[model samples]
Target: MSADNAAVNFSELVNKNKQTLARLKESPRLLLHRRDGEDLVLTTAAKAEQDQTVVSAASRMLSAMARREPGSMELLLDILPEAFPWVRFLPEPDVHAFAVELVDTMRAADSIGNNASVAQMLTAWQHTAEVHSDPVLLAALTQDHGTDYGPVRHP
Candidate 1:
C-alpha cells in the first residue's frame, strides 16, 4: 500500500477510536490519571515515577486555573516537557506557549466543552515521532506465529 493510503487508514482508525481516546476532549489532568489503580501499579517503577510527575504537573495547572494565577500557568508550561517527554514533540515556538494556553482555555470557569486540543496534539506528535522506521517485532508478528523468531533480545 502507498504511504498515503497507510496514512489515511491510520487516520480512520484514530477517528474510530475517538470514544476510546482518553485525551481527545478533556484536560490532561482529567485524562492522565486512570481509575484502574491496579493497572498503574503494574507499570515499571520508572514509568510510574514519570507518570506521577506528569500527574503532579497537571494538578498544579488545575490549581493555577482555579486561582486564576498567570504565573502558575507559566510555571506549568515551562515544566511540562520535562514532566512529560511527549510534550517535547510539539511543533517548535508554540509548544510551550500553546500548552499554557490550552490549560487556561480548558479550565476556564465558564467554558462548556472540554478543551483537549493540546493533549490531542501532544499525543499525535508523540505517535508520529516515536514510530520506528523499521519495527522488527511488528513485522515478525505479522507472519505465522509458530515460525521460529529466534531469541527475543540481542546482546
Candidate 2:
C-alpha cells in the first residue's frame, strides 16, 4: 500500500536479485505482478504473523461480544445489508439467523486459522439469499400439496 517501491515485476526476482531483495526489506511490502496468474505479495514473515494475530484477536472479541451480550448482534445484523446488498432479499428472521451463524463460524475459523471456512459460510448464505430473491422459486417452494389435514398448533 505504501507508494514508495510498492510493486515490481515477477521477472525482477531473477534478473535483479540484490535490488529486489533490498526493496523488499526497505518497503513494508512489494506486490509481485505476474503475467501468468495471480499476483504475489512479498513481505517479512514477521509482518504476516502480526497481521494474522491481530485478525484472530478481533474475531475472538466479536464472537465473545455476541455470546455475552445478545444485543451486540443487532449491530452486526444492521451492517449485513450494507456489506452485502443481496441480504435485503432475505426475510428479517433469516437475516438474524445468518448473523448468528456468521459470528460463530468466524470465531471457529479464526481459532483454527482456516480462512476458507469463513469464506464458504458467506458463500452459502449468499446462495440462500439468491434463492429468496427469485419470486417464482419461492412460490413453487411454498405452494400447498394436499396431504394431512392436521390442526395448526400454536407455540
Candidate 2's C-alpha runs over 4 A off are 1-5, 127-155
1-155 per-residue lDDT for model 1 (tens digits): 22221121233334654543433233222122234342111223555567656655664567566457757556767777786676665555556555655555445421443335546755664664344223674465456777686778856
Model 2 C-alpha lDDT per residue in residues 1-155, reported as the tens digit of each score: 65764798999987997889898677878899999989888888998899889989888987988887767888788888998898999899999998888888989899789778888989998988888999998888878877877998999
Judging by TM-score against the true structure, name the best candidate: 2
* Deviation of model 1 at 109, angstroms: 10
Pairs with backbone N, CA or C atoms under 3 Å apart (clashes), candidate 2 = none
The C-alpha TM-scores of every prediction are 0.30, 0.70
- The C-alpha RMSD of each candidate to the native structure, in angstroms, is 19.9, 7.7
TM-score of candidate 2 on Cα atoms, chains taken together: 0.70
Candidate 1 segments exceeding 4 Å error: 1-70, 108-121, 125-155
Worst 10 residues of 1 by lDDT: 1-10
User: Candidates' lDDT values, in order?
Assistant: 0.49, 0.86
